[model samples]
Target: MEPKININNSTHFSWLSCWPQWTGYAAALWSLLYGLLGLYWFLGGNGFPFGKNDSRAEMMGSFLSNLNVDVGGPVIAIAGLVGTVVAIAMKMTWGSRFHRAIFLSYAWIMSVTLIFIVPDSRIVQNFAYLFLLHFDLLDWRVINQVFCIVGGFIWGASAIAYFRLTQNACGNCGRNDATEGSSAKATAKWGKWFTYFAVIMALPYGIVRWAWALGIPLGTNDSSMVGNEDNVRVEAILGGLCIGGGVLTLGLIQRWGVIFPWWCFFLAGKQIPIWFVMVPAMLMSTIITITGLKLSPQIIFMMVNGSITNENWGQFVPFLFWLPWGISLGIAILAYYLKRRGRCKHCGKL
Candidate 1:
């Protein structure tokens, strides 16, 4: 049968199609929840309705403290709204291409902003203080729950759509007819290998996180020695694991193969799909690696000043892990899938 092509005027590649339905669904949900939470923060309101840290006044005060009322305030609010709306719109069948562009733009801008803000010692300290002071004044728990649920729903819906779009036997890039030879075999072979690579890279990290959460003390150290010695160790180990794993995975993707382990036969000169799988994997891994590297110093400072103690450091932890990790992971998976669909069936090349 001839391959198919996606002719929906969607210039942007559908990278999320590589993984199972659940991956896209989960990612979409995470993006939406994070986007909405960011929106709430920008709007000078607490998204969490019932948590101790869910105070509008405190959130607003924090915003004002870090951002100038005239420039920063308006920019944040407008950006937040636009970003949230665009993210939601991307799930729709008609405007997904445009919406995806907008969503990516927003994410990039916010990521840059976070990079600048997180490094500033003064900003980190003040933000932490503000959050602690107003912790109990707002209703954050409910708001957070709502965001989670809504975000999950969006993710689920978008994931379904993405899956349907990719599963079409039609090839991407409108290359329905092509030569048949070694290329076909190569394409099929590489596709499976790439999928395996992604799974292998992601599995260990997930396992480590799960073990850490379960109090396994699996050699995790705290990059920011904020509280008890034990807590510091735990955080450092986990943080280090994430940062290190991401870096190693990225390096492997870049190198394509290595020559150390005797058990591995394809360790020397395996030319994987560089454009599709390798590039996207590297991009995703870079996000996490860079964020971890950048945030290390700031987290250390916070720990030293007692601004973020063991008991209260949980608040910042999510931001530290989720932002870069989630974004990168989503992009990586999406890119892989898109590349898979776009590959030349006969040549096995993208």
Candidate 2:
């Protein structure tokens, strides 16, 4: 018998029905629990999760450090209560156009605030530390941020599923035969451009790190600092990862993204599962964006305070592009998703 290759891998996720309210309910529960935690803090609870009042204020970014816990506690409590109500409403699956618009807006706002506003670059750095097996640097603040981030992703996913259900589309694929047309083709036309832009954005960071590793000191006059063993090792790692990530990013528009290349003996010519590419791309884009956002304020402050001078400009400047790099990568991933998503077998939607 010939070896069987699963080319129809895209249809397997069709089991995910659009009508399920479990995710929405889960979001509501998360909001409720977090709200109660805020209520505790508002009532003079000893463990306020973040800000200067927190014992880990130094590890918290400047933006977080400046936050007044008293004000934040009440605000968070109110937001959580409101989010809980909105999340529950989303599960109802029926509303007027105006009401739907308002609910959708609220859901996205909640997602963005929790994911982007509540956390900073330290969360990404903390994960890198985990990869390095440096568990000592992991702290409660990182855990709290990760929790908030998870809630944000849950809310966002719930909102999307709700939207698809209300629109009479496949919950798993966000499509119907009627809605299918040239959208994927259009995405393909533009996707490559965004991929290129993302690669370009990553280049400066990679180049700087590689140069540092080679003792070129591209951004500064300090030759001695550039050649240090620790500096070289760290820069090499960062540079290699940056370059490798860029290479992987090209697969979004490359042929190999869909099918295994000839280079792999047994896997060659086999269909690559959609989720294999999507899950990692989604995660990478999110992590990159969060890290960039977290670093922006601090980087700007450094530039303003003259803390970043010609003596060490190379170390700090290339990172300034990270925000755009992550954003472009995210856009590229969206394009790839749009291009690759197939007909939903369960709903029979294309």
Candidate 3:
């Protein structure tokens, strides 16, 4: 039997409709939580959502250390405040043309800020996962993580819902631009440039990693150049994947992006679902952004006061690329989103 296409099912994703305004509710609730956390941080409270410093906190501190502690606290608090407002907007503006735009904007903020805090919280409770634990306990950490996972899922859900709603209302482009002044041509043009930039930025990181894997020690002192026996193999593989993702980004602009390439065995030539591309791309982009933010402080510290050695600088090569990579990837994702939302190519009537 052939796998099905998501035409009729687009508008009425059972999960999305099952709970109307769930996204709104979820966004609002998390907003309040972030507000509280922000207050705590602003007040110099040692505590974060789940617990205190661990690897993730250390990671953030690695960045945080560069700034005056006095400034950092307020910065964090403000991030929370921003999240709160965005979340409220997400819920309050359900039917407006701005709904998805708000969602996307908030998503970018959360991708960096939320992912930053959640990782710290998650690392503390992550061990619970090893025991096959349900983690149903009513502690702040568990509650926070639960909400976080739900929030992440909601981001994807909102994207899907927005696409469906658009497809159903405007069968063609005529009605779309009427409501929102954004044009398909403009969105596509920006998307193409962004994808090119993303691909360009990702190349250096991948190459740097691959170089390390080859035992070339592209950017590190011998003492710091520790690697597992198979480190070379693993790093090489990772580098390839990085380059691969970059190349695949071209699909965002090319026709093959909308319809699967003929080479895709089972999915060949099918009209690709927007969510299929956007959600994962968004997820990866978030992760990349998080990784960069987590490590940026450490990198900065070394350059400023830690160490200025050539080898030490070399180690930072891959991480350095993450800056541009993250920004480019985010833009590319937004572009693809605009393209698809502007005019969905496939959706059967319910």
- In the order shown, what is each candidate's alpha-carbon RMSD? 12.7, 6.3, 9.1
Off by over 4 Å in 2: 1-21, 54-62, 221-225, 263-265, 301-307
* Clash pairs (backbone) in predicted model 3: 63-297, 219-314
- TM-score-better candidate, 1 vs 2: 2
- Is candidate 1 or 3 superior in lDDT? 3
Q: Give the candidate order by descending lDDT.
A: 2, 3, 1
Angstrom error at residue 80, model 2: 2.0
Model 1's alpha-carbon lDDT is 0.42
In candidate 1, what residue range of length 10 has the lowest lDDT sum?
118-127
Residue clash pairs of candidate 2: none
- TM per prediction: 0.31, 0.87, 0.62
Residue 44 miss distance in model 2 (angstroms): 3.2
Reference-based TM-score, model 2: 0.87
295 Cα displacement, candidate 1 (Å): 3.9
Per-residue lDDT of candidate 2, residues 1-350 (tens digit): 21121112353344334224367888899999999888888989876767766555544452567677688889889988998998888877546767878988888888888888888777767766654567886777778888998899888988887777667665666665577665788899789999999988878878887888888878878776577787787777778777888998999999998899999799999989888898888777887787777777777899999999887888778778888989999999999988887665555555
Relative to the true structure, how large is the alpha-carbon lDDT of every model? Answer: 0.42, 0.78, 0.58
Candidate achieving the largest TM-score: 2
